[model samples]
Target: MKQYLQSGIVGFSLTVVALLMPVNGIAQSIGSDKNTLPDIGVVASEALTVDKEMLIGDAIMRQMRGQAPIIDDPILSEYIQDLGNRLVLQAENTKFPFEFFVINNSAMNAFAFYGGHVGVHSGIITSADSESELASVLAHEVTHVTQRHLARRALSQQRSSPLQIASMLGSILLAAANPEAGMAALQTSSAISQQMTIDYTRSNEQEADRIGIDILYNAGFDPRAAATFFGKMAEEYRLRSRPPERLLTHPLTEKRIADARSRMARYPEVRLPPSLTFHLAKARLLARYQFDPDYALEHYMAVNEQGNYLVKEAARYGLAIALLANDKAAQAQEINNELLKRDPNNLFYIDLATDILIALNQPQTAVEMLEKEIFNKPRNSVVVLNLANTYLTMKQYSKTIELLRDYLLVKPHDQLAYSLLSEAYKSEKSYKGMHQSKAELLALYGAYPNAIDELQHAYNYTGDDHLEKQRIRARIQQLRDAEEKLRNF
Candidate 1:
């Protein structure tokens, strides 16, 4: 079973990398101008258009969802997306929309695919000592997208057979996730020379590092964090017989570390304080993804025992989450209440507190609290989703549907909202409504064929409701159009 799962993951990862490859003629001009940094925007401007990249990215993302264990936590997704966008606003030549996701893997690595999709492993978040360190890695990945390194590589090596290029790209991605598997893939493929691939990858890494520091500095993060993180990774690489997956692709050498430090020296030293959200995000990964509630509780208790007040508070917040996960609802509630006393307006504390209340079988209390929060922060998706969940728990199917439907109107791409709406429809015994909600959810992941079939089922269930049937047919046509557009790439 383990081998089967591993094979499935590798195959899926390859499909993702394969779909992002540049078309035949798009990359021919990539290396024509030696003076230019393979500026993908200039070279493939006509061939590898932004719209095509989006189509490719969206298609691969759907395949990934179907195969990988991508975390579906809305809060974590929102936090990472916000962080990526913050950096994007400061980045140069960003022509595509940036999307961030967390892979439920423990490998200390991150990667950027076509378009602006960046995937960070949960382990990296837990590994960082401060928010800036995490931001530094994200900045580096963002640079890859902004500079168009992947697209350039696709264009530069367009001479290689498609299968060969796919194999190389797949190996790089596998290496980012697991070094052993990646190395094995490389050994099996004779399509590309190891040394050549290494040299090109090194150049891309250097360029991304040089540009990433500037983006990090401009975005108000301490640039030194990049050097610091790289230095740490270098040491880890030295200690291990086989380096981590990140080292295989990034190749953090002594010179790279020194260069990052030199770049940091150019900027004024800034001791940016750690962000609370960063701590909460790390805590969420520990309590949820790691599935080690006891370990989280113990680790946080130790940190609280010796750390400063700010650190202590962060640790306490983590402990509360751990407590909740361990089914100690009352204890978690007590900790949340105390935290709320210190900062009553903290959404994180309030949301967790509301969750504790619901776990304690106090659904009405959860509803009252979340409703007030929603009124205060009307556009807050997290609070609104929480309220919708509370309504679902109370078996108020109509209220749940109404809230989710209204929210979905504004943010139709929200996966969690669609999922909740589907559940509400199921509870209400509305087969047509249930399938329709599911269709929207599937469509978000680029599962157009499945989505179309779902709408067809809904149309069938509509029977005599001509109006509803017409609406379903219209949505099916839209899905077909999207599928056709994807195929054009």
Candidate 2:
């Protein structure tokens, strides 16, 4: 089977890969005027249509699922998606739906792929001092997609072989995943190729920054955050021999920092209040994703005792999560209860409370609370997944299956749902359903052969049901065709 690169590499890095050929478009004057932003809209679709871009993006995303250390936390995933959508709403020429996710890496990097997929490292969230700083990075990535920079770069490389294009993109992704191996693979390419890629990316970088700042401002974030974030990254890594992956993909020049500050000056200064959700999300990362549970607990406890955090509630929230991680379930429940009492409707608190409740062996209480959330926010991934998990704990296999089947209809790409559904099916002794669900889970990871084998297993359990067998056969063929198409692409 042919494997593509991990998806969600930096927007500029992907565009840089496309720099395998010549870049089009005249370099617009960056300082043309403070009032009017340049219109770098979508280029010609004849070279690479939206459909093709989506297909390529999906292929890369599948490969990424197989290879990348994707964070599977629904709460964090939901938070990032909501944040990205806020910017997407203000963005122009948005031709596709947007999906945002987080990677479980400590290195500071963020990336966007052909489809509306954007991913940020957990490190970025932990490092960001404010939500706007995080939003600023996201806004830039969103602009890359809205402006169709990747498609434009591909358009310029229309004469190149598809495999060559894929290889370039894959090498960058490999570098992101394994720097030494990836750098070796990249060095095999010509030095001239690397130079051209950098030279062209500079212009696109300018455009993305200019447009992204506007998106950030329009979305009601601090526009100066763009400048502040850029300056911060540059200064932090200034004396280092090796910069962060973000600085590598998005080369931070002194001029870029100055330009961001100059452009941000055009917007009116507004002081926004502290975002509790952002802090909570960051705390979640620190407590659970970043450090050892014991260390995280001590860190949060110190923050709480010292009272030296951006948000006091967020500090306590972090402590609660750490307590849970350390298996102090009773203490965690007490903390969560207090937090919930204050913010009765906050999903972050509620999600954690649900976990705490479940851990306390109060499945019925957890079910009741989550059921209410489901009623209020039907089809909400966070609530639904939590509820499904609660059902599994309660050994309500049939209910778990029913709930997940409905949930999957809405979120078909959710690997977590498929995994849960597969377990529920197995627990309920529905062998065919178990195999079928497992097949989809494998497919998401781009394991086409294994997924096909799973379907065949499911087919064997069909017990001569002609219609079911026919459907299985058709599904198997579809997987085969999809795999074949990906090989060529």
Listed in order, each prediction's TM-score against the native is 0.85, 0.89
Candidate 2 per-residue C-alpha lDDT over 19-117 given as tens digits, one digit per residue, 9 for 90 to 100 = 101112211322334335434343536556666766777766786776667787788888999999998887655667887888877777787866677
**Least lDDT summed over 10 consecutive residues: which range in candidate 1?**
18-27
Give lDDT for model 2.
0.77
lDDT against true structure, model 1: 0.71
User: What tens-digit string does per-residue lDDT give for candidate 1 at 1-489?
Assistant: 000011134321221211122111111222122244444566754345566566656665665565455676667777899998888777766666788888877767777776678888787888888888999999888877776665566566666533344345545555434456666766776533642443326666776787677678778888899999998788777888987657765778889888888766567788877798888888777765675878877776676677734565677888888888788889988988998999987777877877898889998988888888888787677787888888988999999999988888888767778888999999999989999999988887677889998998888899798988888888999999987765543
lDDT of 2 at 301: 91
Residue 210 in model 2: shift from native, Å?
Answer: 0.7
Query: Which ranges of candidate 1 are over 4 A from the true structure?
Result: 1-40, 159-200, 306-310
